[model samples]
Target: MADDHGTSIERARQGRMTSEQIRRRMFDAALATTGTRGMTLGFPGLQMDDVIAAAGVSKSSVYRLWKSRDAFIGELLNEAAATFADQLSDDRALRTAIEIVASRPDLHATADGRRRLILELIRVVLEQNYYSTIDSAAWQSFLATSAALLADDGSESLRRVAETLRRGSDRFVEAMASFHEAMGRLLGFKLRDDFAGGFTLYAVLGSAIVEGLAVRHLSNPAVTDNFYLGPPTLTDEPTEWAPSAIGFLAIYDAFLVVDPDFDPRTIDAYLKELATATGADSVPPADA
Candidate 1:
């Protein structure tokens, strides 16, 4: 009969979705739900019925994939934590900052010029990171999960979360350290002898400042938008400096000192190499 044939076709279509496919759909739906509703300790707001509706999958399919709701949530959190490092390790902003420095050959000739270049790069990178962080729902959810886990008492889940956070933190620090090392080598600067932890500490502090500002910005956009007029430069009038820029510069000044042994002649070669590495086509020649 036609009715029987149609029912069989519908069943075949539903059967084509493998268990893995169903699980992936549920996972994506859960992340989207958490991102919109915000997560808390134990992910109390993440209901199975809600995820099932959003995923457009049957309750039977989801239940067949996991033993229970708690088991499903555990897997979801584990998967999220596993991906935390990759999600946070974006290098686009750093590459852009490098391009900005490479395009300004005139700034490399003088100590003051180089310092100004560094300041401008920091400001630009920080602003970019802030905007990127706030705009990403996944990043927001990760931050919230981290906060909740860190505030909880000792538990197996807390330990797992802490380890995951440490990995993400380490990746972020390494990215910043690479940025610092490259700038130091190119611009004739080095970590101060008295700075005990070197680039690692510097990276940690910088990340903390940006993360704190981002968290505050969620409640008050004005805090992130606030800027102050910096002192006049030799060739230009005063310019507006963001709060993060001022904070970062203060730390930069305290932690870094000019390298007395650096050779100015090698700057061109360094810039060329840097431009190639960052895939930048607009870097001006050293003489220009």
Candidate 2:
């Protein structure tokens, strides 16, 4: 039976399987393995034999696809980095933000209420983004690549990884800036006159805070649970505020202020437009 099974496997490989198909299978298997066991610096932990076994491909097939182990690892890292960036769920986050705004009509009536609403949105969104990152293995791998920049190795592989990371970072920052700008306009806020960096800078700072906290959380998960009671101005009752939320709020306040000319009556219309734009109306409830 074992001999028969081996023969069938060999027969399947010799059939019409394409090179791209084989490479994809091996790449996926390697990612799954890295996800479970965690990645090591320089990817030394991802053995070729393990990938072949997991992918159920012959050794010769893999070598035919990638001339050397280094070549395979380099391509894998590049692919992983690109996937991580491509997977950023800004639409989902925007949908959630729309819901937060739509659910609280009373909050839109007054300045304080509007301020509180923005704070709540920031806290919830920050937590949501942070948790999502920690849950994703591809994201963790991409993040790990950041450390590779610290090494003095100027190899072509490292340069590709760095370029991919930069592109991803730029894409993230741009997406975030757009999101923040929309939310700020919806809530009758504008960047302060004294704020020179504008929304782009806001996005950059916000990204740093979330990523910094995420790295810390990896080492001490207790950081997630570490929150202080909110002051009375921000919440009616004492609310637990994560450090990241606090930092974000501080940045938000510094960067934005209430737009005096904003008409509160237009808020509903604004939200409706935002919901339509983000396709949030079709999005199911968070609990659902």
Pick the TM-score winner: 2
State the displacement of the C-alpha of residue 30, model 2, in Å, after optimal TM-score superposition: 1.1
lDDT of 2 at 259: 91
Model 1 C-alpha RMSD to native: 3.1
lDDT of 2 by residue, 23-90 (tens): 88888988786764345556877789988888877788789889988899888877777776666545
- What C-alpha lDDT do the candidate models reach, one value each? 0.75, 0.78
Could you give me the TM-score of model 1 versus the true structure?
0.83
Model 1, position 220: C-alpha lDDT score: 92
* Worst window of 10 by summed lDDT in candidate 2: 279-288
The true-versus-predicted C-alpha distance at residue 141 of model 2, in Å, is 1.4
Compare the candidates by lDDT and give the number of the best one. 2
Q: Which runs in model 2 stand beyond 4 Å of their true positions?
A: 1-15, 36-38, 88-91, 220-224, 232-235, 282-288
Clashes of each: 0, 0
